[model samples]
Target: MTSAPGTYDAAAEAIAARLASGGAAARIAAASSLFARGDAIPHERRAVMDLACAYLRLHPGRDADGEPAFDADDESVRREILHQIRERFLASSGDRWDHQQIPLTLARTYLPDVDLSKVHIRSDRFLSGAWVAGDVELSHATIECGDAEHLATLDDDRPHFQLTGEEGDLHFEAERAAGSVSLFDQLRCHSIDGVGVTVRGGRVRVSGHIGAVRLPVLTATQGVSISGLVGCSFVGLLGSDLKGEVSIDLEPALSAVDISWSAVHGDVSIFGMALDHGAARVAIHLERLTVKALHLGGARVSTCDLAELEADQVTVRECDIDELRLDGALVDGGTIEYSRIGRLSVDDATLGPSWVRDDPPARVDWLGDESRETVIGLNIVGSTTEVPPQGLIDNDCVGTMGDLLLDGFPVPLRRDSGTARSGAK
Candidate 1:
């Protein structure tokens, strides 16, 4: 098959010759052949070769026994390749492969079964139709690449798909300043790990089931859209300068969504946010969330909608200069403490005893309350209460015709409360 220098046949012959040499030089030649024939070789052939090479390199003169023939030092590169396979295609173990590397200026090619576990890629590694094995670990690995439109489509044909490192470990620090990294299908990981999975100044579209994603500091600048179920816990989103809306469709009914410190300039709507502790920007919308502690520090919520929520406690510290809407909520034991609000509306919501800040005099009238009954509005302790003329209240004077409670005290339920209290009309 030896032909011209630039011919495909010539390149295949060169690869076969190198594999036959059986030495470091030969191994390097073989590696070069695999890289060159990334797209040329079929998936089945590549998989089989990868497995054989790893066994030979790692097992090292031992035939399925604890016997050693070749020295580990003599076969280090081969061992490294096996590690790369594990990290690149298989699961990541604590033992990392740190010396391997991938060139950046390489042509846009196809890299099947490409392993980069614990490997520090000095250049931007871009490949199309890349088939990755599950349980791959890229903890503390950095990948910086070229501009937008450069795509890397991972395999989505298999089930139980995931990209994760060891427990409490990161997978990859892929930085495509302008390019894109599309992770399709199901991606699973361990909790309290995956510190930073950033997609900065680019577009990252992931259509799959993401579980146990932990990024203490997560930033999606420029354009980053994450669709599908994001079952992540203990996260912090900062500076999400999305030109469009950021939508998240999570599991219904109290799905835990805890953001330590997150700020989104664009609108954020989560299907359910069981917030343990976090800060957010703009607006926070939850479907069935259980918020333990929440702080919207100087964030703007045009409408804070809560649906099927079962929050034991929710505290909106600081202040939010926006409209607050709470609907169909079932809070067991918590408080909705607001420092100051532009407009607040609570409709068909159940609140466990709460304390409103004594900052502004606002209006609140809705259903389901465990506080004092009032005609127009209930007067919270240390806060002023406003009573509209036609507001409902429960009183002892009339059976079902009493005023709403003000400050846990029974008040008359009358349409003309101001006039009645003033003894007019």
Candidate 2:
């Protein structure tokens, strides 16, 4: 780790010295010896972590003579410190930390002594589950992620898995960074802000749940995904490659979800989701994407998508799609504009105004049981691609798109469609 502030305490320094002494085998023995002492009290253990974190915060990346700062030995010591925190403090196979015991407020308990004002935490241990009782900031800084050799020692359960999971109420905001991060297990956090952040590589499984999740101008390479999110505002997807089948089955409901200027490596399947009543604006949008399949069932999204969408009992309005292939899907007051589908097949599906949208459903007033959400209106018209000289709709088949789901709701959509179809109507 570069540009770190190192001030090691007795406990942290002792562990670092042990790790620096021997090779991987010797270090493994040292680690085994450390854990063999058994677990300490939650507060006591976190204090040890705080002491180590304090050291990291105070570490200076370079030396006075302009020589190699944090030499091989120093880097090894830093890596050992991170490994200690991960094995003893953060969650591995499971995060048995003090999340349940700590308060949600930052700095009260979670990483309690993190001296952000003094130094930043330059370790990969945070990728694992931790009950941070405070806000974490990697914003507007160059986040040089931990490297491979150091990351190799962190895999408690698997091989070469640097990140395993995260637990508790988390507030992570990242911007302008190099390197990568991976979410390898279930994460339960209330907030994750990744605005204008660029990650070289990342992986998000379908099991993570966070509230108020926001990502704008986020770019990642290859295997990048944010799948199966519970509820949050996904502002925009820029140069991100999402891969997975998503299912929204949570209570707080999904917020403004917008997807634009992105690529989907596989099918985007949405099923079983509802809107939270407390949400200010609510909607979903999909623009400028070249995806494979879109299967929607028991969901509610604002008119958005461009290819092969199948749905039932789902409420939508002014849907503009490309490559639309509907089989056993319903079409209420939605439009199929600018699609590449040569033939649109709708079988065993309803076609007309939504049976549920007679009354608008507010975020809190969604009309459905605990398990499913209800769709209201729908409209379809050929706009851009998937047409034979003439579009599926009339020449006046132009419409503007609305804001994303949840936050952008109360705001009306500014579309180019002469035939506007909104559930509010």
* Top candidate, metric TM-score: 2
**Model 2 reaches what TM-score against the true structure?**
0.38
Cα lDDT tens digits, model 1, 62-120, are 43665344443325434444443444332245432221222232112111123343333
Worst 10 residues of 2 by lDDT: 157-166
Which parts of model 1 have CA positions greater than 4 angstroms off? 1-145, 148-181, 184-193, 230-245, 252-254, 272-425
lDDT value for model 1: 0.35
**CA lDDT of 309 in candidate 1?**
53
lDDT of 1 at 159: 14
The number of clashing residue pairs in each candidate reads 23, 50
TM-score for each of the candidates: 0.36, 0.38
Against the true structure, candidate 1 reaches a TM-score of 0.36
